[model samples]
Target chain A: MSETRQINVSKSQVPKLAIIALGIIFAAGLFVVGFDQGHIFSLVYGEQAFTDMYLHELTHDMRHAAGFPCH
Target chain B: MKTSLFIIIVLLSGAFAGLIHGTVNFAIVEPYLDQAIGIENQNLFASGEEEDTTEFWVEYEGYRTWQKSGQILAGMILGISVGALFGIVFALSRNALPGNNDVKKSLILSGIMWLTLYIIPFLKYPANPPTVGDGETVVLRAILYLSFIAISGFGAVGFYQLSKKLKDNKKIIALVGYGVFISAVFIAMPENPDELTAPMDLVNEFRFMSVLGVTSFWASIGIILGLFWRKLSSQKETTHYN
Candidate 1:
């Protein structure tokens, strides 16, 4: 008799997949948004708020890039 | 699957909402800045002649173009970074034991983090106030403060849940909490439809874009680092087991 074995996935894989998916989505979204200059302008205020969040993130990167990193 | 997709949509929407809020407030506040600075031209420097005005306007337009492009790049970077951070943190805490730490503890940790990282810096630099500048109107200011608190609060909870090894639905719950924090900005500062029709006469697109680009670039870096840390830890665990 031949038996079939089920392969179980770990919970940890979920987050990794989520992150990769997010990165792809972000990259794709930018590509689409980049083409529409008017839409980009129309979304300026929202964009600024986004920029504020990015600034905080970028500062973290700059520190790391400078070799003075923080978690 | 539905929940995960929903969470992603919510996150993206939050980012988009912030952009809209920022743009409108920027438009409104430019006039206020002009009034305060006593400059007839939207640009800071004004030589009182038609030829000077024409030259300044041309220079200003070029500057505005640069700024807008910068902002779009910044926004994309920031979104990816934040998403990556969320992913890594979630991965790391997938094994947290339930009821070991409650939401309250997470909030305290969040407060400490905020105090140490954000509040302290601002307090020390009190004189150098981090004004949103030509972007600070009454509505915008309120939204900014409220959103900061909300993001910090939810971010802490989400981080804590991950730390506790929560799985499946619990992770989504935590993400939803984070989403609420992000969405608070829009709830606090809804756009006025009437303002949309108002002339862009005072708005300098270039300056606006520059600020956006610089800010987003920085933010993406933070997010990427967080994700990297998680990925590294996970790989180490796999190697040890193998």
Candidate 2:
């Protein structure tokens, strides 16, 4: 008589939803800090946002320091 | 898999690292930024775009303070964002990474990412302080820079995947392959259209400081995340880690 052994292992699959959420966070954060030039504020404040450039001004130092192109 | 815990740890690690990055920049990089902006102010006065008057100085100081404060706030934001990406990659690649423990593996990944994502693109388009970039070419420069980063990151991942298919002894070919691929792409990419008007010494010094700030962020994230993973990843919760 031959005996067959059984084994169960959990590799712990990564959740797709978590990755998706992180991806969104990554994109939004990068855009706000690295690339935003008042476009985000414009959605609510209109053309005046371009002149104010609140977020742009806030992230200005880092934008330059982290190597994103700035004027 | 303790999904909520993973996310929390990732965000926390990123926020802390980003805080360190922002603080380091405030200490070291701020001087260079102030110097460069001073040059910009001089140019503004020369071109009659802005007057050297009390009102102008008041407004400038106010905005400069705001910008300075933003360094830390933006650092936190950027940290969480980049940390999220790092977390995702670490979770996916933990099994295959070369290290005896979580910290070492995380550090190895960080080094690889720092080299491919930061160092490589930096060589092609180094960091520039205020008064260096052209307003008209800003968009183009941004696009070029982002494109290069994307190419390097994905190319590295692609080469790594190729390496997995080969025998252990043949893995070096993948490294060589990526080196050749990235070098060719580096040459093929277009150069920055803007002329460098800033002093070579100032620009070079600013770049050195900038590298230090970013390096700090990567290293911090690696250590913090590694510690978290090792501590939280108990045998009962995540069977694979055992």
Candidate 3:
């Protein structure tokens, strides 16, 4: 039987990969937290008033504070 | 200081500043909004035939609930996330800017960023409450606002690049030139007014508060981060810097 070995990766590539991951994560976070207007929540809830209201309640202050449209 | 460490500190500092700013906004603006612009219901009973028609009033459950804890939490989150993103960009652009401390440089950079990224676009299309404006016009309004932001951003970068040729007061000259250019664009762009649903004063107040909250957050982030970075730099030894 051949001995198993770990996959080799370039050391310099680690930081580059981490940076890309960070960017992607942060971009998604900003979109969800700031710019999302019930689009995500609506998927599961089917565009109900309660869904919008709940999301709005959670984000309304942040939206105005961060200079995003809330109304 | 290590760049990653510096980024973390800047993000935390921004969050702190944003917390304070958000607290103030929640305390003052929330109450004002609640009292001034709480509901917008049309009169069902009163007909146009009625000689003495009273104002229509309908209390709504509304979207947002005023909660102190929620506001504070949101504020801190806003500061950290948005600040971190901006902070990274600010750090990357540090070479192009001048300053002993990255944090202090951030102050000037953030100011320029705000001017171009937000204020310019905002001037053309002032922020409205969530309930304001016709629903159909949302797309057109968004396009217009985005275009304005893009113009301001590119114009600013162009000005900065051009200012490199000038030796004396480069920043001031670039700012003046950009301001003039933005002003011209502002004048040329036709006004796209939306139907006002809320009371004018209430709408204006909300707009003012929104601008104030954002401005305060940026100002605090700059100052707090600057102080923290300077303090860290003083404690550090002679380091390898590019």
Candidate 4:
């Protein structure tokens, strides 16, 4: 009688979950760093008068330097 | 090496390479920006506007230092983040790709990524220097630039899907499909008609330097990751013998 080898399957799930989580976080970071040059923090806080161009200005040189459109 | 370990190695290698790439820019290009400010002021003066009254550079103090550090930080962030994404995609596609050496595969994929993501869009709308054009047209310029990226990306995907469906000459068909799609989009895309605000020579040089910087960064990441990955995998092999 031949016996079949049983493979453990549950161990693979962790990395997949981690990858998904990392992907989401990375995507958000990409957006915040690359795209959302303004109103991001204000949008998060739901504040009506907390407008700031600091982030935009901070990232301005990097944006143009990296070949992303800024002008 | 395990996939997770390999990814971490790649990410770190990529970040290190990116930091180097950023350092190159800070050393070479940052001075040009300061020069560009002066030239742009001259341009304004030539147009009969008060030269010193622009107040553009005056509004931003401490930018020189900020720009230097920011480049390095941005490079590291972009390197690791994009490297992670590359690892995931490469992991998924490894089976279908015809190569045993992961390094060669990574270089090939990096070339493709650079072409589609950066080169194509760059050719269409090269990187502009600070104060290169009218601020009013920025939104339109950005939209057009992003549209080129989307089309290139989708065209590549469409080619892949179409290649899978075709029985013969799949490569030819896919290439033709992608070529036609990109050409049509490129032709249809709106061009920025505004007069150049910065010196043409400066704009061209800055664009060239920016693209070269990105090319070096991606190339370094691919090479570094390849070396690190090979070492890690070899170590894993030896450990299994113990």
True contacts kept of each: 0.05, 0.63, 0.18, 0.30
Local distance difference test, per candidate?
A: 0.37, 0.92, 0.64, 0.68
Which docking category, incorrect, acceptable, medium or high, applies to candidate 4?
acceptable
Residue by residue across B1-242, what tens digits does model 1's lDDT show?
23374245435533553344334324433334334223434333433343456776786565444443343344444344333433333344435523233232323332344343234222221111111222234334333433454455456655655635876557666556555654554355444212221134323332343234333333433333333333333322222221
Q: Write the per-residue lDDT of candidate 4 for residues A1-71, one digit (tens) a residue.
A: 44445432212222575467547645764554455546676666555423454555555556677776664
Q: TM-score of the second chain in each model?
A: 0.31, 0.97, 0.74, 0.81
Residue B24 shift from truth in candidate 1, angstroms: 6.0
Worst 10 residues of 2 chain B by lDDT: B233-242
The 10-residue segment with the lowest total lDDT in model 3 chain B: B50-59
CA shift at B58, candidate 4, in angstroms?
7.1
Q: lDDT for model 4, on a 0 to 1 scale?
A: 0.68
Best by TM-score: 2
- In each prediction, how many residue pairs overlap at the backbone (N, C-alpha, C within less than 3 A)? 23, 0, 4, 0
Q: List residue ranges in candidate 2 displaced over 4 A.
A: A1-11, B235-242
Off by over 4 Å in 3: A1-26, A42-53, B41-63, B66-69, B95-103, B165-173, B187-193, B233-242
TM-score of chain A of each: 0.29, 0.82, 0.60, 0.56
* Most lDDT-accurate candidate: 2
lDDT of 2 by residue, B104-206 (tens): 9999998898999899999999999999999899899999999999999999999999999999999999999999999999999999998999999999999
